[model samples]
Target: MIGRYAKLNVYQEIFKSSDFYRVAGGAFLIPVALLIGLMSNTAVIASLSLKELVLIVSVLVNGFPIIMEAVKGVMAKEVNVDELVSIAIIACMLTGNYLEAAVVSAIMVAGALIEEAVSDSARQAIESLVEMTPDTATLLRNGREETVKVETIRKGDMLVVRSGEIIAVDGVIREGATSVDEASITGESIPVNRLEGDDVYAGTTCVDGFIKVEAVRVGEDSTFGKIVQMIQAAEESKTESARIVDEYAKWFTPVILASALLALLFTGDVTRAITVLIVGCPCSFLLAGPVTTVAAISRAATEGVLVKGGGYLENMAKASSLYFDKTGTLTRGEPGVVEILPEGGRSAEDLISMAAAVETGSAHPLATAILRKAGEMSSSIPEAREIVSETGRGVSGMVGEKRVEVVSSDAYGQKGLTTVEVRVDGDVWGCLCMEDEARPMATKAIRDLGAKGINDIRILSGDREPAVKRLADEVGISRWHAGCKPDEKLDLIDTCVGSGLIFVGDGVNDAPALKAADTGIAMGLRGSDVALETADIVLMNDGLEKLPFLVDLSRKMSRTIKINIALSFIINLIAVVLGFAGVLTPILGAITHNIGSILVVALAASLRYSKG
Candidate 1:
């Protein structure tokens, strides 16, 4: 009679608690308790046949291992996801709630399988990245290039490609010229014209002409290598919801134990105590947050957006202020000749020739722009030696023993110029002016943030103060920090933490700042080595406008989490009340309580597929 009552109470607890494992574990115990009670009752009333004995033995044989495992796991103090399910079985066995125990275990196993399937859905993202690079390309070998696996293309190898071929590595154009479509790497839609001496990135297609490139970076050192690293780093970051759930479970288990003990003391009923223990397993509640995050991450990967970890996702939702790195993040990192002014009794062509000759060896976008303008004039470049470049300060080279300098106006110690001076051996030759145009989407992203009540926007850059200020003015960002070093950028981010900053950057130097910000948005299309890995959100399409869309999505996800948590707490509260009042049977209570847990899980998982 005592055991039967105990079994009933156990079922009641399983029904009351939102923890799936504890409830399921208790449910599995029900059949064993039922069999024991039935056989004991039968033995006293009638003689059992040998065939009947065999049938009972078979049922016990099937159930014994499962029950034994559960008991062993609990005794060993191993609290895995399955551990609570085991304890639930034990509770059901003691209370004679056989059917409820089996049902509970079945539900738990099913839910676990579903969660596993959903989490594994991330395989597609990695596969998509792998498919981006071609399997093989022609390498210049034995005085003539032949087809070979892209992976086998070693450093310093020369590769020849036709007009329609993709560039296989980060290399300089050793021979020929072509218009390369770098839309895959820099998101530049207009096919960029390349020539002898121009650099090409791996995975970029040669849209027009033909070029033989000498490999500079190969294998894992290429841009593709950094992207793969970013994908892996993003996958490893943790989510805030999972952390909170852990803390909740830590306290929840103890509280449940206390409640069960109190109920046993007051009523002097072991069955009632077991019921409380079974009900408070804390499994489903623990699963609620991770399931939602995993689902959202899976959905994002399908859309070509890679969120690094759970923590990144959570931070993006709460981000307030946005710190934009002007290059790549706000403006196309490319610079074009916006204006040309003549000074010092010289023409625009003279200034262009001088600037281009000095910048021929430079890698800056502005330098390239100047060089192209000179090339358009068919101006011959002078052979230069002893080339040197400095941040803020521009490129300087010795052309035929004549010192030539092509520095930004700010670097020359002059204020913002609609025109830059060209100097030869410390005498002004002429001026060639240029400016970086803001990306078409930059204005819209800022406006959208304002409309969404995120009013604060700032720019932090290591570029010349004048250039930084000019770009900031163009973008309408009033709060700006120019001439900042890498460490200073990180400090600026830390200062903005009270406002919940979102840092957007694409260079390797921006990595520390990105990691320090509340949410780091990497412009993946142009982002450098460390920036991609340290960032939380990656704009794969290089669209700054996606910022608003992601912000809205994060807010919606946060709201969903709140709703699920509220529902879980309410259901648990109601079940507890019903159990204390003796208004619910162990079997009905367990079933009803589990239904609520399932509902919470379903709602949380829905976030993954939600268009919101």
Candidate 2:
């Protein structure tokens, strides 16, 4: 009997491949043909029968995928929501409520498809990172260089890196010297001079030097590989909200099923009860929240906002307090020479020249900034010998038989600028003060945050108190703390744990603090490996100005989730009432319920197109 019904050959491809056609085609066409035969032969309420057939066909096609999913879940030692829906459909079918079964089944499939599509696209940022890495590297074997797959390159292999070339591995520079532009890595524009023994990272470009490095790590062991691993790990870590939603669904799905069944039993009308059960399928209700969240995440990625997942997206909206690291987060990390106080009636150039000589051959950012400034002053710098860098203090060296010290402001009791005191021959010769300037967008970002109701802003830094206070004043921030070591920052984070806290930072030093916050936002444009990996949210452009926009997006997504949840509940309520009133048959109820589920999912996904 089933073989005769299955003998349709012209539609074989449709049955085998088409998702929509296979489930609905048979049920729909069969009932419609019967109705037409009855009408042509003799009228016998054929129109009402056609309505029931339409309902059944809709439920079966939409609900089949759900049934299949449930079967897979059972086989895999898991509970499947789709399988439960399939069970409900089977019950409707056995009771001769074919219309209800078809509607319920079809709706379940549509909801699952919607959720799958949105979540798949949400992780596109990870794919973007994968595409940015180089696939091959140049390896030197027996002094003969050859291009090889990056994965095949082994440690201790000497790799040649040319000017304008991306560094292929993380290793110490074994030979050659050149200035490397690590803007892609550190977000700093100034090219860093790399001599032998200087560590170089993968993905950074060699701007002006031919260098060879003995690779200590290659392929998946490289720094870039670790970053990819971190990204994957972070994505796997679910936020609290997502967990809540999962728990809610574990109970919500079954509750919805029981309610639909109860409505049918109490009404004592087979058709109306079936309608209630079919309409009460919780597909739309289940999809409402996730769809909106997924859409928000996807849109944020395109705008350079890499939100980790749907759960974080929801939390960011509710962020009431924000704790920011002072140095790189709110201001330009570089400390440039802002003031050159010449003593003994000497010109600014003279002090700068004297200071630059002492500051040269130093690794500190302030030292580099002063040297660069002195070079621009057209002041000749004499060679300094026995150069010494004092830990947490300043640098000293012999400049033409004169002893000079360029100490930080706190070291010399200076209060305003990040001062660099210049002394010649153990006597105070002059002062060259450098200030950490606020970023061009810092003030605007702060103002926008305030306007968005994020009024609690605090600046914590390892810098001196004066510099910290000055920067906070410029940005209109009320709370400021300076001289905070890495541990101190973590302690502060621990205090703020119960309250929502967001730590914004970009350096490797900020790793601990980033990991301790409610949401760690890394300046993606120039974040270090530690920052990128530890931080939950990565701002791709590293534009602190985008903070306001991100907050706005989060709030909008939260609102969307609320709306979806509400709609799901409202639809279920209406379907239950109608079913018990005997206004809908089981088959019709399932079809209507499936339609509602599809509509809810569509509404949730519409968040993708929402304007920020």
Model 1 TM-score?
0.65
Candidate 2 all-Cα RMSD: 7.6
Best by lDDT: 2
Write the residue-wise lDDT of candidate 1 on 107-147 in tens digits. 44434334333333423344445556777888888897689
Prediction-by-prediction clash tally? 26, 21
Residue-wise C-alpha lDDT for candidate 2, range 1-612, written one tens digit per residue: 011111111112223445535544644544564465457444336544554555555554555545666677679875445544566677776786564465455444443343444444444444554555678888889979999888787788899998888887878899998788664444355788999998887767889879999898776666556655555544444545446656776775566567666765776655564455455555565556655565566566556566666666666788877888877678777878776777788788878888888877787888888888987877899899888988888888887778878776554345557676787877676777777778888888888898888878898799888778888889889997899988988888888765557778875568888788887888754544555566777775567877888888888777876776787778878877877787766546655666666666566556656564
In candidate 2, which residue ranges exceed 4 Å CA deviation?
1-65, 71-79, 95-111, 118-123, 126-149, 155-241, 266-268, 299-313, 343-346, 376-412, 421-429, 483-496, 505-516, 522-527, 538-542, 582-612
Please give the RMSD to the true structure for each candidate, in Å: 9.3, 7.6
Candidate maximizing TM-score? 2
